[model samples]
Target: MTKEIWLNLPVKDVEASKAFFTAIGFTPKPDQSAPGERACFQAGKSIIMLFPDATLKQFNGGLGVNDTSTTSQMMISFDAETKEEIDELADKVKKAGGNVFSEPSEVQGWMYGFAFADLDGHRWNGLYMDFSKMK
Candidate 1:
């Protein structure tokens, strides 16, 4: 069984990427820092790696960067403890120079969520589930 997992993503700027993740409550793993290659951040059990675009190109055999304006491969989701927390995070992301894609909204009468994009245009969704309202 796998004990842990890490998600690797490519970005144009490492410092900006780090700042964005920090604002979203991810902590950097100091041991993983290196020169001109990769940076790692941890959010609870999830690990997100930000690699430079050139490194990512080399790693994937020279694949071109995705056109984020037209398509997104995935949106990272974080679970919030409450609806207020979700809203608070949305505000923080914006204040940290990110963009909020959605205001908090109810879903299926049970969950509330919002969406934001990081400095590098990576989209993230934060959700709060009301389990007590589940049928």
Candidate 2:
């Protein structure tokens, strides 16, 4: 059985990426990170690992990594506790130099959230779902 999962992402700068995530409320794991080579952060119960492009290429069998700025292979979504939390994160993302591509708004009358592209152009969606409104 899988007890733990880690999301590995490629970044241009490990320290910069670490700073960006930290600014947006992600808890950095210094003990698990290698300075200038890799960074680890805790996002809720998931572990997010950021590695430089060269390092990630080696991990992915030397395949070319997609240019997230132009093409997206996937979008990671996070569940927020409330609409206010989504809004707060959106603001923090903007302040941290991330692009808020999607403004906070209602979705399907039950979920509210916004999307943003991190410093590495990785797209992330923060959503708050109202279970009470579910059919």
Best by lDDT: 2
Candidate 2: tens digits of C-alpha lDDT, residues 1-135: 877689999999999999999999999999999989999999988999999999999999989888986799999998999889999999999999999999999999899989999999999999999989876
Clashes of each: 0, 0
Give each model's whole-structure lDDT: 0.84, 0.94
Query: For model 2, what is the C-alpha lDDT against the true structure?
Result: 0.94
Per-candidate TM vs. native?
0.91, 0.97
Residue 42 in candidate 2 has what lDDT?
Answer: 95
Worst 10 residues of 2 by lDDT: 1-10
